[model samples]
Target: MLILSRLRAYLRAVYCRQSFFPGPLGVFVNPFYLARSALQEAMRDSAETLNGRLLDVGCGTKPYRNLFHVSEYVGLDIDSPPARARGVADVFYAGKAFPFDPASFDAVLCNQVLEHVFNPDEFLAEIERVLKPGGKLLLTVPFAWDEHEQPWDYARYSSFGLKALLEKQGFRILNHRKLRADVSVLFQLANAYLYKLTERWPFSARLLFNATVMALFTLMGLLGARFLPDNPDLYLDHVLLAEKSA
Candidate 1:
């Protein structure tokens, strides 16, 4: 078991740092099972800018901690069942407002969090309030994801929509990136549905069933990529780097 775990970790390290083939099959070969290597790569690329006192909103297990060169890292999340299950974060708050004073952080990382917020305007307002002048906000939101973490999943944001919303909240967009291509999105949707369809089966059977389906869909995605032109509209998620006025 330990050997398998170590092997998985080794593969993940390779995938995040050295792998960028982006062929249809290459993207779906996520050894860590979440297909977040691209996202981790994006964060690592901005390590220099992310340095200094940082806040991780909705940080799950601080999975991207090593990617940043921050002086201080403070993770904050709501004290809910879902958050507690993750067993992470430095502080947990139950209210809508943040506990920190204004301009408290040099950088804020909010990963895949906006879609779960009930009031995005208010949520971003709090982040802006806590960020220092010229501080950067690194955020990711899904455009084509299935609803997970039920009751909390509220909305999805397109690349344009996210940019406009951030600007309205007094941020200057520095960079925006679509994280997944058409073939990847197709692969994810098919895999997700297959998993859902097998939810009621026994544990071993469900695992076997989903694995078989995923393997087939992965091949299909590769074939689709060969004939399909790249389309931004079919992107699965987006990442943004925005800044507060100095």
Candidate 2:
């Protein structure tokens, strides 16, 4: 088991270090790059609207802190016993309501967070309440990703659905982008399924088997992305930029 753990760690290290495979291999397998890199790219692309006092909802590790030039960055999450042990947020709430007064923030960033909220409409309402008039809201949500955070993973959003929701909440949509192409989505989902299949095997064997599977799909995905047109219906995530109505 230790050997397997070491092997998995080594493979992850290699995957993180190597940004992409060479040439055309890079385009298809680009999605295989460390997940953080892709997320960082998304954040950087949308950083312009993230100025002023910012709020990070469900801020785990505040991973995109350096990407924005905000005056103050406050993090918020649900206050629960398990969450407290993780120490992942600056402020934790006991109920559905936010603690702050209305129109307190200039911008809000919510990444990979909407899916976990039991009442997305109400949650978005709170965000709108705390954001000043003309404030910006940046969000990223999964459209095609594996279940995570266990029972907490509650929803997924398509670009159209997200746009409608944001508009309904009195925010004007400025930009919406797909974080990955169809090929990347296929590769990630397949990789997830294969990884689970290997879990029952010896750790070392599972590591090697999953490694080989990942390598093969990485190449296939790269080629597909390079050769095929992106499908609008498929993507790993949707990044959105919206402005609160003045």
Candidate 3:
């Protein structure tokens, strides 16, 4: 039992490190490899511009912490049993207001979190309040993806809808991108479905089945990209870099 637990931990560490910008092993094992790879690239490109006191909102495991060269890094999450199990928060909040002064942070990262917030307006408002004037907000939200995190998942935003939400909170959009569009999205969805279907199987059987499916789908996605007409409208996620108005 102890050995199995250690193995799970080691595998999780490897997945966290390489699942986003996957190599061969990651590509096969990670069901969401295509979308994650795109998100990671976008984040890495944007991370170059961020510095100083930074806050990571809904920072589950702080997977991208090493990407940024910041003076101070603080992680915040809702106080919940799942969060406690993940050991995800440096400071947990009550979901009303953040435990920080206005304009306390130079940058904020809210990756893959907005969809889970029931009151996005209040959430964004708090983020805007905490950010220093001209401070950056690096956010990523799913546009076309499955409902996850069970009943906590509340919303998915289109590109325009996301832009409006940020602008409504007095944020100026600096960079906006759609990740894993068109054929890649199709492949990703198929892979996700297959992953779900194999969930009840034994660990080794599930891994082998999903890995084979991922590899095949990845190849098909690549080929389709080369031959098919591009469609940016159908995408998996939205990546944005916005700034608080001065």
Candidate 4:
């Protein structure tokens, strides 16, 4: 049953381009999709309940609507996106800052987008301004990883750094947890290089590579979590929650 579920998951991963592992098969197994889902799940674990006007910054394809609650949902991105982002977002800003009054939103959920911001401080300030007093801010950023989106990958956050940054911008820290980086996290990353092997072999061979690497990594993590005591570095998702004063 376990193997069957994993096989199903892998097939879904491949068909969906959701991940390098098989499902979430993005433009060559993008990491953000899986990371985003993991982040959202973490947010829920931390008592996150979205309400009021919401801003999802750098919202590429705006993937969090399923979990978002709102008086409004506004998405902002750096590029001119493929879709017009109609009624869902109410409006789509061409760049980072939302064109709205201060204290306008009750919740701001920014997942996997902070590393891309050239100025995280300015971005947080914008979030502060837009969030109503005592509103919520949920964010996710990688702590350990590679240089991705080259010209963009500006910063990563340790629990302390993320907390300090948020506090400096007037947000009080409510919950901050470092993402545990297991072997699976590393394996997912390794498949990135695996794609290059496809030039030497068939696509099925590449998928085979993906399956093998992901399986190995997943096993390592499961075993590590079970045996390794008090290891902080293994958690692969950083979940942060801060609040504006009311």
Worst 10 residues of 1 by lDDT: 25-34
Please provide the root mean square deviation of candidate 1 (C-alpha atoms, Å): 4.8
Cα-based TM-score, every candidate: 0.81, 0.82, 0.92, 0.75
Q: What's the TM for model 3?
A: 0.92
lDDT string, candidate 4, 32-138, tens digits: 33344455557557434677778787666665565565677877655444535333344557556778788888888887788777788888899899888999988
CA RMSD (A), model 4: 6.1
Off by over 4 Å in 1: 1-35
**What are the lDDT figures for the candidates, one per model?**
0.76, 0.77, 0.87, 0.65
lDDT, candidate 3, equals 0.87
Clashes of 3: 0
Top candidate, metric TM-score: 3
- Candidate with the larger TM-score of 3 and 4: 3
Off by over 4 Å in 3: 1-17
Over the full model, what C-alpha lDDT does candidate 1 score relative to the true structure?
A: 0.76
Clashes of 4: 22
Name the regions of candidate 4 deviating beyond 4 angstroms.
1-14, 17-37, 44-48, 81-90, 94-96, 181-203, 233-235
State which candidate, 3 or 4, has the greater lDDT.
Answer: 3
lDDT of 4: 0.65
